[model samples]
Target: MSTRFSGKVAVVTGAAQGILRGVALGIAQEGGQVLLVDRAEFIHEVAAELPQGRGTGFIADLETYAGAHAAMARAMQLHGRIDLLINGVGGAIRMRPFAEFEAAQIDAEIRRSLMPTLYGCHAVLPHMLQQGRGTIVNVSSNATRGIRRVPYSAAKGGVNALTTALAMEYGEQGIRVVATAPGGTQAPPRRVPRNAEGDSAQEQAWMQEAVQQVTGSNFFKRYGTLEEQIAPILFIASDEASYITGAVLPVAGGDNG
Candidate 1:
């Protein structure tokens, strides 16, 4: 099939790994110039792995307005315009009981999950409006439908609200704003105990069990693949989905039900 993004410029935040990486690579594979933004040092490595000369990397913390502005400025300087934006920077913190969660924990969660999407939209919306067309896809989580993680759920729910509000505000200006909520997808391995100095076989086994339990919560009884999650993002960001706006396309494999 022909690449759907020939001559387009796409920006993807949190492009170091997982669904963000998938979205960035997918856009590049579709012939779009990509601006890969992430806070991790590995973001440079990941950006280098994209098709040569088609991608650029920016290391910035999306939790800050200055960082988000800088990333968007870099993209505009590199490509002149952003045709697509995939807001993919947010994630859940480790599970903790509501009563035990401290005020600082709530603050951190809100910053990590909401600031990125909000600032990203702020940075791109004006240029898109001026260009008279663009697509913005915010990556939310299925947790929004359930109280899996309180602060994270609240953040993603905000994302859904932002998507709809932007769509309604910009539909006449030719911008399409949408959200894609993915179900349980295979996540990268987290370091056991957060501060452990070495790996342990027993810990590994326990981690595996925990992962399995999480996946079991999904109706499909398996974690979805990165590609499967990216498919809906690509569709929503493409002209093929021109008529689609203010949509919350759940790529959750029926897990939200």
Candidate 2:
């Protein structure tokens, strides 16, 4: 309802699915020129759903530096300048106890939950600095403090560190960097199942344990809605939060982290 982003160009990664779809649409609805990025071809469909929308979709593997670089470059080419960036690509891919995780699984968890935010922030910094100002909102998780996916927790912790350090270092240059540590969310069922690891009996138990920990840690004992999880992210990206940077706001139902 607030056209705070009118005329702004926003690039949202992981826009192909889940709560990100809602985040991307919220940006478009607020009058930002939406550029959706995801590895899925269905990202184009998401772009098409924007209001007054001529969807600009970029297909990229955000886990790679080259992919992050290319998405930023391509968006700049099409829209001329990026006013906002929502680094929503990362997530916990597999849930398992720390010792039980295979070497590759550990590597995969780090890549899935940290590298994209790193690559994205790294890729966009120079350009935003050149333009004199911009905002970046990275999606982190409350699981950073709890869970079976220790690798994912570490990765999100890294994201939290990245957000604070970048904001402090660049605030004088008018750049704002922030992150949202969302609790469990009422996410739509994955369109493409993310890492089918729950098939085995032990794996299912691990996954179940992880889920219970997440919910139990929260006061509400339930998942936040898509709106509840993403509103703080969008708020931080808007001028309404112009002075708020270097902080990771917890969107969980009172998890103070």
Candidate 3:
């Protein structure tokens, strides 16, 4: 049997590493040509790891209009058409008290977490509309579920709202928009300490305990790996999920009610 995404073209933002890499690689494995977009210079390595001849990488700071436009343009230039997009760029900065969070921090959060997704969608929608079919999956966070950390929550909340609005507005054009809000994904690449000695065993134990505590609150009692989190993203982007749209699918271990 042929792969589900054979001959399709996908654009995955923040594809340099972590969950985004999983999503990109998953698409490639299914025979889709993937464009891996990221601001980090290491994106080339990530792209290379995808199925040979099935992936390419573009480096651009998607927080700016020019950057988002350039990345989209690059995908179009390479693939001639884009059928799927996974907007997986965004992260928390230094956590600060809600009351003490600076205006700059708020602005930065919006730019970092919301604008890139918005602009990428804007840049790609017209093309998808012309083709009369497309799927967009925005990466949100469990933070929106009252997880504290105000700025990050506010930004991801915007992403959730955007996904809903876009799904409704473009459903008539054969465009599907959805968001995935994952909670406490297993140790992110950038967060894990490099040297074992640098991270005390007690500290590591405390972190594991905290993760277990959080996971116990969810439906699933264990944290999800990057591959596991990528499953829903690929499903939503494929025709297999033809009837799904404007949905916020939470991938928390079990905490979501």
Candidate 4:
């Protein structure tokens, strides 16, 4: 693998599992010092799995601004500077049609999907501004155009807007903001389920519909692998994408959402 991240310090939120876990490991392999953040205690285990001294897992409820600020503060204390931040703390908690979603459920979905990225960006900007350069890679979803996840779609839409607006606002200050809109991805079962309650048959059927929509919308008619999604995110974070900012690259098999 390339040592594009040599001497860099990266902060990866949602590093306990899924795409974020892959990102943390990738950064370590590429010679970056990584601070992995998640509310899950398993985050420490993931950190320990990294090369010695290259990973430090931090547990923080990034859904809140205070937690986000604290996590970024810890990153600075541990590594002295943050060169990159990958916000990956989001997923569709409940997959069902828009009409079926209760007010509380819709609110929960937005909070789960959008708040972490918002708080993370708010907290990390001052540090990057002080250093005069940094990169932020947000994990968005192409489900922004799919069914049974209207709230999730809106939340990711917000993320895309945030990426573009931040890039425009801070590009001259040497910070690059970007995102990747991934399609359905095949990965190991979640160590922590997005929803602990049992899914009703109706819910399951709705979820299946959403899944079908995801794959069918893709030009390849298939879900992507973990690596496929991670590659573009790391590329945008690396100096290789120095001239790229304010862009949302679709890693969705040409879905372009």
Which structure among the candidates has the greatest TM-score? 4
TM-score of 3: 0.88
Candidate 1 on 1-257: residue-level lDDT in tens? Answer: 54899899999998888888988988898888999998887888888988889888899989999988998889889988999999998876534545645797787777888889999999888889889999999998777755435777788889989999989998999998998988777667732122234435654554465456557667778878888998888888888888999988888777662
Residue-wise lDDT of candidate 3 within 48-70, one digit each (tens)? 99888999989999998888889
Using all chains and alpha carbons, the TM-scores for the candidates as numbered come to: 0.89, 0.97, 0.88, 0.99
Q: Summarize candidate 2's per-residue lDDT along 124-200 as a digit string, tens digits.
A: 99889999999999999877788678999999999999999999999999999998999888877887677865457
RMSD of 2: 1.2
Error of 2 at 31 (Å): 0.6
RMSD of 4: 0.7
lDDT for each residue of candidate 4 in 76-108, tens digit (9 for 90 to 100):
998889999999999999999899999999999
Least well predicted 10-residue stretch by lDDT in candidate 4? 192-201
lDDT of 2 at 157: 92
Score each candidate by Cα lDDT.
0.82, 0.87, 0.82, 0.94
Q: Once model 3 is optimally superposed onto the true structure by TM-score, how far is the C-alpha of residue 185 displaced, in angstroms?
A: 0.5
